[model samples]
Target: MSNQPPLAAADLQKTQQGNQVARTPEQTLVGFMNQPAMKSQLAAALPRHMTADRMIRIVTTEIRKTPALAQCDQSSFIGAVVQCSQLGLEPGGALGHAYLLPFGNGRAKSGQSNVQLIIGYRGMIDLARRSGQIVSLSARVVRAGDEFSFEYGLEENLIHRPGENEDAEITHVYAVARLKDGGTQFEVMTTGQVNKVKAQSKASGNGPWVTHWEEMAKKTVIRRLFKYLPVSIEMQKAVVLDEKAESDIDQDNASVLSAEYSVLDNAPGE
Candidate 1:
């Protein structure tokens, strides 16, 4: 064995402290997760395997990508991060299993923003898996004689083969979701609806709905089916879209306050 001097105890402690510091998440809006008001809820919402620092890092990175999210209320943003963690989702991934969309700031008189929490297709699957609710999920394109149909099923037919129909149009896309005890649910979207959604998404600048047409179609049906499926409270919170359309309430409140201020300014003997 080669003879070498061991590192000093003080130096070793310093190195350990540095590593701990490096692992700590930087203080940002997400840092509010550790505050007493949020800490317990975050702990309950987060998966046992996830730590607060990791959750903050994942959400913080997402905020960097979509700068608008920075304007989101800190409490609401942290709640969204906790919801994402509960769903076992990483916001930094390309699929963006969860998103925190800010609304009402650029035009609202209150100048306050609310965060809309929306979950991706993968997040849906992950949430279903955790609850042991999903038995299997799949979709495929199949040709039956002269017509091409998207045949979706649980375990049997997830792949398409060239057994028939040398030439045909893919007329529809179907999605199958099999639940643990409940029977399978089949949802379909015709090519007409597909084109309509495509056009709408394009008009609104949603490139993914056009680029990943097939995947988006499948997700569309699955999200629809979620209306009938019972989900855990955490899952429900993660996927619910915050309704900015209801900003009318905020606007009305602002108007009422403005009227009161006008009356005060126009007093009879000012």
Candidate 2:
């Protein structure tokens, strides 16, 4: 038998009090937000069909396409900027938007940008259409701080809807990331959501995409890697069992008739 005292209230109190979970106070406060409610509030507060990941991807994609970003051989501008967000995707408001972390040669860190990227709502939509994501970027800065706010949303010209004109507090997105391959390659390991509307109706349906190659879009980077055009994708709805697990029957032999004609005998006689 052990001599240690039973876990008493004093012991439990000491353990509970001594525990210090590692998270910044700001991080803790941000973590405390009610995510679902925040999503709704953000949706009500911001433009339609916009999210942070979508924003980041679109801007980086645009930069990658530009001649300056493309000439990224440890020369020129070494590739594009990556967008990151402290406020993760809840699909609404400032929290839903991603901050542009300009990557490559221009920034101190991997995706850190000396110049800002402001993506207007219309520009965001355009970027989405071309790059399969929704985010516009601008180099315009609204404030100066280490953790500065960087947000460019709902370009004033594109506010066709009444709610868009409402005084939605726009915020800036800021973060840092890295570039690779003379700035030829950039990666965003993320899961994201996109809204698709009926061709006729403007109503939205948020389609979610997992961050793997299995789910795909044509002309997306993965599609370009395929050697063959019109490659087939098999969607399996049912499973096939291993039917021939073991051989069911033994082999049978057919009878052979042998005559053994004397061709050699004729040669000997000759």
Query: TM-score, each model?
Result: 0.57, 0.17
Model 2 lDDT-worst window of ten: 234-243
lDDT of 1 by residue, 110-190 (tens): 255655454455555555555556566554433345333344545544333545654566556666667667676666667
Residue-level error in angstroms, candidate 1, position 138: 2.2
In candidate 2, stretches whose alpha carbon ends up further than 4 angstroms from where it belongs are 1-20, 25-37, 50-117, 120-270
Q: Give the per-residue lDDT of model 2 (tens digit) for 1-270.
A: 111221222332343354488654223222222233322333343234555335434434444433233222211111112111211122122321212221234333323222222222222222222221112211111122223322233431111112332233322211111111111111111112111111211111111112211121111211122111111111000000000101111001112223211100011111
Q: What TM-score does candidate 2 reach?
A: 0.17
Candidate 1 structure, TM-score to reference = 0.57
Each prediction's number of clashing residue pairs: 0, 21
In model 2, how large is the Cα lDDT of residue 64? Answer: 40
**Model 1 pairs whose backbones collide:** none
